[model samples]
Target: METVRQRQQRRQSDAAAHRQRYTNNPQLHKFTLKFSEDTDVGNYFASHRIDVTNSTICNHCNALKLPTESPGMCCSNGKVVLMEPTIPPLLQHLFTSQDDIAKDFHDKIRFYNSAFTFASVGVRFDRELANAKNGIYTFRVQGSFYHRIGLLLPEAGSNPHYLQMYIYDTQHELHHRTNTIPNSNLNPAIVEDIKAILDEVNPYSINFRYISNFPEEDIKNLSMLIHTNIPGLDQRTHNVPTAPQVAAIWINNNVPPGAIQKRDILLRTRMNQLIHISEFSG
Candidate 1:
């Protein structure tokens, strides 16, 4: 029995084989002699003495690259969703700011692979959803996520661990700053201060990640609907409203003069280009 993983691997292998076969001979049965390769496009650019800015090595796939064409899309295309977290403005200050105060957090980032990872805790389970007789158990997944200072695990009897700092500060951490960090002079305050910065900028990181992921998913979904048989969502693209449509909702009562000029121009241009073409007689 082929598992889900095995089926996915097999499909991928078949796709690679098919693409290789097409690349070897790109001839079509009755097409207008149009053809294209499936791999290694960089070689063609190199042969033509064209130096492309993007590297031939894909940063995401690492296994495939089409630097001259799609730098990162050669492998995943729209199937894989890559979520890039937007760094909050305040978070970037620690890394780039040259202020004397911010330099403390900046050093820890360079020295240790220090990063912020917050976990949401404590949610009330709805009685209707948690009915054991019907075998349904779920918790409401909603809360305000924030960063903390101490070890990842909550200390015993601590209601909220947001402000609790690890007093021990361990030899590995304490000695790390004292021995190697600049202006240390056996100072232990660096550890606590760094943690403080991470706590304050917690929500910024979450918002950034969600914003980046929110659109990439829908855009990829829109691509799939291009070939769909559905009428309304075809190339009309009603999923995302146009600028004019969005603006019209706000100023429904009083539309400014010349407001529809841009829309009128587009309509006129489309109408002009719709000329009847005579069939070719050979």
Candidate 2:
């Protein structure tokens, strides 16, 4: 296996070679060389890169200090050069910053992760067959999402209970109508299925939160409230619903089509609302 240092050296060499090629033929590889931080450094990165801090989480320690150099390439700030047919001067004159023009073409090129669940949301672009006729260059955008279910499970010592989860695409007026996972905590099959779905959607921003569902009985009760759309559940003696206290979460049940709503559903328990433990009708 190649060591980390060796990998870096190889990458640097490749970048230097790429830069050298661009230098020989500046007109052909102008965009790739445009963002070179220095002529000497190979493999110029064009996107915005975020830095890490000592407080970031790791398996060994949370406070471990990391070196200043980033381990890998950073995310791009949504900028791409239109290398084909080089837009007409009339169109080029309309934009000030190349970045702004990229934005104007695809205003919604972004990704997000919910802070309340292990779901990542992002956009996917395909360049294979974009604007072939017009001599223009572009991409086909597809919505994508990824979720990790294990993170939201209850701790080993906690009382075991049945749970169900679903994902909704607020942007497209679509949802996983069926229960995506049933009796989730007790079964490993649900995790496998969820991974499959993640591969299918392929969302860009995946957000994970320390979230777990209320017991099956609790979710059934909350579903009743949502179904009825009750003005308010009595809470005089009840504690305000907060994180780690939710009953259940479902997205896009009744929202209007093509509407962008908050992606998370946090269900919490309020003491004022009655919770009855019903006997199973086996």
Task: List the lowest-lDDT window of 10 residues for candidate 1.
Answer: 263-272
Q: Over the stretch 42-88, how does candidate 1's per-residue lDDT look in tens digits? A: 65454546455555765555544445566546556445655667776
Residue-level error in angstroms, candidate 2, position 197:
27
lDDT, residue 154, model 2 = 38
lDDT of each prediction vs. the true structure? 0.44, 0.36
Best by lDDT: 1
Please, what are the lDDT tens digits per residue for candidate 2 over residues 1-282? 999999888977986685576447745522332334556544444666555554333332222335652332121222323333544443343233455433332332121012112343344454432535433355656444433233233345542212212222222111221223332221223233333444344342122111222234554522222222345855554443443334444465787887864344322235322222423211
Residue-pair clashes per candidate: 0, 16
Model 2 residue 38 distance off true place after TM-score fit, in angstroms: 17
Model 1 residue runs over 4 Å out of place are: 1-50, 53-75, 104-193, 197-282
C-alpha-based local distance difference test score of model 2: 0.36
